[model samples]
Target: MLNFKQPQLRDVIEAPADIAQVRTNLARLYQQKRQLLTDKAHWAHNDAALFEAGASYTRLFMDKMWEAFNEDKLIGDSALIEHLWLQVVQQEHGTAVNVNYADEAGENHVLFAIDQALHVQAHLTAHELPVLADITDEAPDYLINEKMFPALLQIIKLLYAADLRFRSPKETILQPVNDLHFGVKFPDAKTFTATLKVSNNVAVPVKINVEIGHYDVRSFQVVDETGNDVTTIGKPHVSASGTFSWEAQHLPELTNQTLTLTVEAVAIDTLPCLDNLFVIASGNNILMRTGEQVGSFQLELPNKQELGITVNSQDETLTLHYPDADTQIYELAKTYSFFGEWLEATLKTAIIV
Candidate 1:
């Protein structure tokens, strides 16, 4: 999800009572709009009396609601209110409405500019009362005009949108991370490195937690590109279950750079032996022995690299050759029953670096 700061405005409706009233009015207007849209078929069939009655009711209701909004001063400053109203109207109605005013110096000043995300850039200027007068005079006609129902709906939606911006609870957003693969030798510990880039748009700093599965994390550290210890930026803690969590403050927003996470973890080695089938690993090689001879076994690496197994039918020994090493001979004592048991044990015991 994209993260960006929400637009800010002054004297926004903040009081609980004012917000409650605004919400009530918004709901009423929404219901009215829904009814109007629902009766579109009847209106289109030239039900003149029905259309006139609906239009009159909507106009009177909206005019009374607008008067109430002004009397309650839900949003202080007439110019600011008009600016927000026109901005939303323009956006939702797909038509730009003139919300700007010319100053004494003959310079046109925008009351507010709304972008695609409804982000507002507001500028206080003169001639606000005239703009408000224009809106008030033309609003009743707009409400009665059947073609302008969407604009009326936008007015209601804008009120709720602004209310949410000011009164809604803050939320912390987190992006999902891809799956991680850790490679470690059996009965041995290996350190693996993963990189994460943090992008935050909220005002407060956030704590990040990375979870690792199927391994026990021994140590974890965070470093910058220059190998400087930036872990002091936050208190880093590693749970016994292999979760590394840390909070960083005042980190620079990056478009491309990323922080490095170095973790030292050991693979779990409690794989149970079944039916004389046993998996043994020494150095960088894992050897599986079976009582019956098998032609071959296919092994897949965490990196999607496939490893070919070399079978020694004489001893019923299957050897997995790592790409980084040559095939080595191992002396086997007991043979296993099937390759499936060995494969399961190898998967459980294997860790990618």
Candidate 2:
């Protein structure tokens, strides 16, 4: 394992290391990000970086979202807009409605503008405690009603009165969440008491694992609240022993608040690099002998015994192999299309060396 105390990085800008090579990986990413950001005016703002991987938005809207989240920047500016309707709506209602509303565009095509607005609002509230604060950031009465609240309420009232008055959120095509199941669930609680229920359709008992998305509750003491874990709450224990369930309880000792729970499942399901990853092990990096041009490659580790390679991990040329083998990065045709940003050149099972 690579172990070192944090060193103060001053003049040394770029360097490479083998495992956990922080500088190398970040430098490469910086280069790639710079290349993408320089040409497009869309990703001018910080928040638009999320879209560069694969997003479809004009440069103006991306800038708007970033402004809302910046610490020094408060909720102002009307330049950012994804949909024309939102621009019109804000223009009409902004001043009258106490809308200091900085707008944002999010992940959807239509009503998602509302979602983006709400998301930005939620983010703003959570970060600044805007509700309790004075009228410095937003207008006082704007909090009286939201952009969609009045409309949704009107629709609800119409539905209750048996009147087909207002359209209900534009009919949406939803994916059926039937066959796919969250086989196991972990309950976040203090004292870490009770067993959580596991849901699955399989007749035979399959080893299921528990997940609390995006929170590390390892530091929480016994019988303490798992507040930071934004997942399902205290649940009944599963019948099977060794199965885990969690709960929230008061712990007066600890200062930094978090949750802790035990999860029981087979270790086989613990393969971290399975999805979108094929291998993780040591290997002698290789080179391809293609007729057209040469590229670098690595014999990436699948495990202790086997090694396979792709372009994602390391994208340098194999200078050691030289004339003997011209390296080319290859991938599966059915799964991947290209390496890095080359749009047309699809991946193949074997490198055409």
What are the models' TM-scores?
0.22, 0.15
TM-score of 1: 0.22
How far is each candidate from the true structure, as Cα RMSD in Å?
Answer: 29.2, 26.3
- Candidate 1 clashes between residue pairs 3 or more apart in a chain or in different chains: 182-352, 183-351, 183-352, 183-353, 184-351, 290-336, 291-336
State which candidate has the highest lDDT.
Answer: 1
Candidate 2, which segments miss by more than 4 Å at Cα?
Answer: 1-263, 268-272, 275-353
* lDDT, residue 313, model 1: 25
For candidate 2, write residues 103-205 as lDDT tens digits: 3433322322221221112110011112211212343642222343333232222222321111111111011111111111122322323222332333422
